[model samples]
Target chain A: MELRINGLKKYYRTGKEKEVKAVDGVSLEIGKGELVSVNGPSGCGKTTLLLISGGLMNPDHGEVFLGEKNLYRISPDVRDRERVTKVGFVFQQFYLVPYINILENVLIPTIGLNSYSASVEQRARDLIDHFNLSDRIDHKPGELSTGERQRVALARALINRPSVLFADEPTGNLDDYNAEVVLKYISEFAADGGAVLLVTHDKRISRQAHRSVRMKDGRFVGDDTNPVK
Target chain B: MSLINKPGKRISIWMIIKNELVYKKFGFITGVLSLVIATSGFVGAMILLRGDTLATEQLFMEKERELRAEMLQLEDDYRIIMRNMGYNVLILNETQSISELEKEGYASTYLDYEDVWKIAESGMTTLNHLLPVLQEKIYWPEKGMEILLSGIRGQVPVYSKPAHLTDDDQYRSPIMERVPEGKADLGSEVAVPLNLRPGDIFTIRGEEFEVNRVYSRRGTRDDLSVWIPLDKAQSILNRPGKINGILALECVCSTEELGQVAREVKEVLPHAQVFEFSSLIAARADVRQRAAKLHEEILQAEMAHQMELRREKERLASVLIILLITGASVWIFVLILNNVRERKHEIGILRAIGFSRLKVLQIFLGKSALMGVVAGIIGCMTGALAGVLWSGTGLSFSGQGSLVTPPVIITGLILAPLLALTAGLLPSVLAANQDPADIIGER
Candidate 1:
């Protein structure tokens, strides 16, 4: 699916005395099946831009469009429904529901998709196997290594086969080998006709995407088509 | 699976119950305790109320029996007095007339003095002659005379004597031969002598009687005299062909036929006073006014006391039940609330996983409801067993009566759990209304 973010802006009020413009007048678009990365220093509005694109946070101004439906024009409940069906979100912390098993965690999005679907379980099993986590399906997040936990979170995001996946620092907590594994998974998801928008501070992870943009002070400062250089 | 065919709500309820089983022991215990207290209170109240009702009924019945016995004894006393006085008693006042006596070939009797003196001087043979003539006109059976005579004998003194002449050439009396020398003498006034005291020898002249025993005539100037048998009086007075005036005593009648007998006796002896046995007893005992007033007072007092006790008991039971229910509810609510508070992280996860606020509420409430129902049932069963074991065995605090088992205790047990659930509703709803986004954000 084509994703468009137009003139997005966000601000945070600090104790009623100061205002911080996290994302200011920034816009970008991604074609179907394309993987794009937003790279910046910490507190440079990269995460804010990703959050707005994934519908996890509302922008103070501007609009987000997935194909023909404008996300901001609809009620929050409707937007949430659309987001659950069409968008997948991965956070920097993995944010895995701690008490549930890995398989159950991966199956969370499918539960929202339909109350009862036999195929959803099979889909979850296949995702676990794809991520090489079949042996740890019943293990809780606390028992899993950081890399395995991130993999489980990715499986959870992809359970509904969301048209667009948004990842914010998908490998920020992992070692080089685990980060490569996570990056490979994101590239494979993009190759399988799913569009991806990733935000990261790591140049190596950013280079894996088809295109890259650099943001500074809530505005895009650079656009590079050849991200590998 | 088809969404509608799946038991989504039921499954949620099961999950709620399962969660409660895992996390809410204190809430479960409090609910059970509430059921126990409610059931026990209900059973105790039932026993007390039933016992009081039964005792009051018994008291009324016992009082009724005593009143009946006393009334029967009073009637017997009046009957004996009539017999002792040698009179035929009648109940109706207008049955006989002086003209009827004259037409029946007897001397007309009057309430005036002349006829009274003549009859007193009359002999027994003459009285016997009058009896036959009276019988022909009276058309009454001998049983009527027996009844009449029995009533007269009931009124007379137990002992009597004949009047005779003394050697002093003055009148001689069995009771007192002559008046005291300095005192005003009542020469020939008639008197009745009694040998018994109150509550003594109850029979006179072959019939039962009750003697008042004290004989002080109010405003009377008369001779002290003795009561003599009719035959002995006739012989001593030397008046064999005449009779003294007939005295009539009164008695009660349970049937109309007896009253008719009294009326017939009046028709035969016009000067005789006819009295109904019921009216005579009423008058003699002064029972109509006094008994009615006393009964009214007693009934009012009893009813008022019963009502007051019932109200007090209701107030006490209500307060106790309310306090028990409220205390149980508050404790259970607090426990459940604490449980919810501890499960805040779980709640955040569930919300993140797309569980609605309302569903979260349902799960928590469902747990409490299940506990309430189970505990209530247990309480009811225990209460019923206690009632059965203690029924009719006089396990009670009030000295008036014994306790009875009540069905309401079982009903209370059944309702206690529901009440507990209802009590938990507010807290559960509040917990459910908590924003999932905010909870997760806090974390």
Candidate 2:
């Protein structure tokens, strides 16, 4: 398994006696070359599950394993290092730094990894070319269209060649055409032996995944294999 | 559009700060402006203080020089008054009786006329202006009167005395004029009784003489006397190359006592005794000391006034500097805090992509430091220039370069950045500690 979660539970205090079960006793496993999608409506805890699994948020009771290394068992600094080197995250907002160009934006992950070399830069350029963003590499995020920004975000995610990719609503802000393009890139990442855990409410996106999991009230209701279209 | 422009360069924290500053022009510029105002105020105050000290020192020297000139003039006036009063010391034969000298108004005992030369050549510093005089009361048969006749010549110069430029004989003599070989100067009482004038012929005990000038009336013993050539009087009195007294003026010094003058004179003239008119010497010394005391009081008063003014200026500048620094610190704090608030999502995204908390802190802190560095340079130049102009020192770099010394400039340079860093610390820490999950929400 490229990424695994065992008995994960997270809660939020709503009042003195009331709490919301954001993720409760959830368990899932993803192998290399497999793209799994969590389908849920708004406020259904799918995003929370993704956040806990990506080593960004701590679960109250659970273990998150990236290639047999428990993220929660290690120190925060080590966990951060593990996440930067082995896990990549993509969000719906495409939170790009407005002042820097798209090429620098894609190379930002390499800065965290402290691994920028001629080869790393060459790979970034290749990723830009693959995402069809070579023409827009030098343009700031404000100047780029919605589709171009999402593509830039996707390229940034794949730049470090992480073992697992966690994307939350990566296509929520894009048009149908751009969403299809972004989803295609994500599928390609998994095809190249990467593990992908995508969380979204769009059922149509779930059909494109190798397996789909339906979540409600912080629990998985059904897990099924989706037919390849 | 230019892919080749950014290929070999790494994206550093400083580079990020630079780009961010360019993007947020208003915030960075306003921050820099506030820092410049504070730093310039500090630099200006320092320069102004230095200039004031220099000006005060120069003014003090000028005033002291003027006072010295005035003191010298006062001393010359006192010398003239004392000279008119007569010599303060009388060196006579050691065997002369004090009672006989007082009763006859002349020394009964006599000393060699060459004895006066011995004192002058002794290089003694205590006395100057030696005049050898011979006097006696005699009945004149031709004039049909009794008179005290005195013989005198030009004063003897003492080589050891420092030359008083005012006492130069080329300008004017400091004592009575010498009587010529065939002339005489009669006292007012004698001249009135004898009906003599400047060119009148007179006879003194069978010796004929022409009256040179009639002396003005003095209420002292000199009014009843007649001055004539020393050789003529010596011949008439049958006292050749002999003198009853040596009249000399004692040099007045603050440390010189009346007894000291007598002792110094007797050391050179062992055969002669010194008689210093104590009242006359005391009065001259008192006048000089009083003048010196007045000069000292005036100089001290001027210095105290200047110091008071400097203290007032220092107080005002200090208050102004404190206010400026406070205002700048508050402004920087607010600007950086607002910047952190506005860039929340950017920080979140950077953290989510694996940037550490320290890197985020470097981004904000680096921006603040850049602002301070640039402002420090501008503030130093403009502050020094403004200080010079405002103080009316004139903009001459050669005269005023030391006012803006290296230490002052270095402090200004270091102060601005340190202030910026100190003021921006809290906001930068807050930005660094921001949780990526809370900012970039899972939803």
Candidate 3:
């Protein structure tokens, strides 16, 4: 397994005496070359589960394992190193830094590792070209369309060549055609031998995945394998 | 083209800060402006304070010079007046009685002619302008008139004062003129009765003499005297190498007491007793001392007023500097804090992409430091210029290298950045410690 989780729980207190179970007793696993989508409605804990599994949030009670290493067991700095070197994240909001150009934004993850060089720059350029954003490579995010910004965000995520990719609502803000283009790129990442954990509310997104799980109120309600994969 | 390549370019924390500062131009500009105002205020205050001190010193020095010049001129004027009043001190033989000298108009006892020379070479500081006189009552056998035969050689220079070689002693001190050899100076009484004039040959005892000068009429015994060389008078009186009295003017330029003159003269010549015209000497000393005291009082009062003014200015400047620094620091803190709030999602995204917390901190802090460095340079220059202009017209201080000393400029350059870093510390930490999970999940 490339990514694994067992009984992850996260609770947020709403007031003095009331608590909301953002994610409770959620467990799942994803292997190499597999794209698994967690399907649920808004506030059903799909995003929370993805966040915990991505090594970003601490689970109140459970363990998240990436390859053979437990994500929460390591020191924060070590965890940060592991995340930068072995994992990638994409968001529905396409949070590209607005002041930097698209090429620089795609190369930002390389800066986190303090490892930018000629080869990294070449790779960033190649990725920008692959995303069909070569003409807009020097333009700021504010000058780009919604689809172009998402493409830039996607390029930034894949730049580090992480073993696993965690994406939250990756297509929630895209049009139908742009949504199809983004889903095609994600399926290609899985086919290229990368693990993908995608969380979304749309059932139609699950068809592009090798497997799908339904979650409600922070727990998995149903799990199934799609034959289309 | 393969996208211009932009060779040698690499992304780093500095690049992120630069881009962000450019993007948020309003916040960055305002932050820099506040720092400039504070830094300039501090530098200007320091320069003005130093310049004022230098100016006050220069003024004091000028005032002192003027007072000293005035005192010297007044002393010269007093010396002229005392000289015109005649030698205020007459040194006669120790055993000679004042009543006998007054009744006979000449001393019965006499001193050796070398006595005057002894006092002149003694380097006595209490007396100056020494003169030796030999006078006797004689009957002019040729004119058949009784006249006082006065012998005067001229004034002797005291060893303490610089030798005055010229006869132009009118402005300096009164000097008795020397009667030329083989010639006589005839008093008005003797000259009018004998109808003698300058250039006329006259006989004194058995010696033939030319009338070198005829004196104006005076109501004193000097009007009945015939002045000649000391050697001539000594020969006529048959009193060789003898003088009845030594005449001298008491020096009143020092703080020494009037009585000290007689004591000092006695120390030099124990055989001589000094008889000074105390009223004349006393008046000269009183006027000189009063003028000196007034000069000192004026200087002290001016200094006290200057010091009080400087203290008030310093207090005002200190208050202004404190206010400016506090206001600037608060503004910087608010600016960075607001910047952190506005970039909440951006920080979350950077963290999600695996940026370490330290790198995030560097971004915010580096921006603040850059602003400080730029403001420091510009503010120091403007402050120095303003100090010069203000001092030129206000403080009357014009000293070179007073405004932009190394210590003050260096302190200002270092202080502005330190202040900015201190103000930006809390906000930078907040930006660094933000959790990506909470921020990304909220969206």
Question: Of the candidates shown, which would achieve the greatest lDDT relative to the real structure?
Answer: 3
True-structure lDDT of candidate 1: 0.60
* CAPRI tier of model 2: medium
The local distance difference test score of each candidate is 0.60, 0.86, 0.88
TM-scores for all candidates: the values are 0.61, 0.92, 0.90
The residue-by-residue lDDT of candidate 1 on A98-180, one tens digit each, is 64567767776554444435567678779999999988987878899999999998988888888898887889999999999
Q: Residue B61's C-alpha lDDT in candidate 3?
A: 87
- TM-scores of chain A across the candidates, in order, are 0.95, 0.98, 0.98
Angstrom error at residue B268, model 1? 15
How big is the positional error of residue B338 in model 3, measured in Å on the Cα after superposition? 1.5
Instruction: For residues B137-197, write the lDDT of model 3, one tens digit per residue.
Output: 8888988889999988877767676643344432144467888889999889999888989
Maximum-TM-score candidate:
2
Which segments of model 2 are wrong by more than 4 Å?
A227-229, B1-8, B93-100, B124-126, B141-144, B161-172, B199-208, B231-241, B251-260, B270-273, B278-281, B284-288, B394-399
The superposed Cα distance between candidate 1 and the true structure at residue B105, in angstroms, equals 17
Candidate 2 iRMSD in angstroms: 1.8
Whichever of 2 and 3 has more lDDT, that candidate is 3
Per-prediction TM-score, chain B alone: 0.54, 0.89, 0.85
Q: What C-alpha RMSD separates each model from the true structure?
A: 12.8, 2.8, 3.4
DockQ score for model 1, please?
0.13
lDDT of 1 by residue, B347-402 (tens): 65455445556666777777777777776767666655564355434433443223
Chain A accuracy of model 1 expressed as TM-score: 0.95
Model 3 DockQ vs. reference:
0.62
- Descending-lDDT candidate ranking: 3, 2, 1
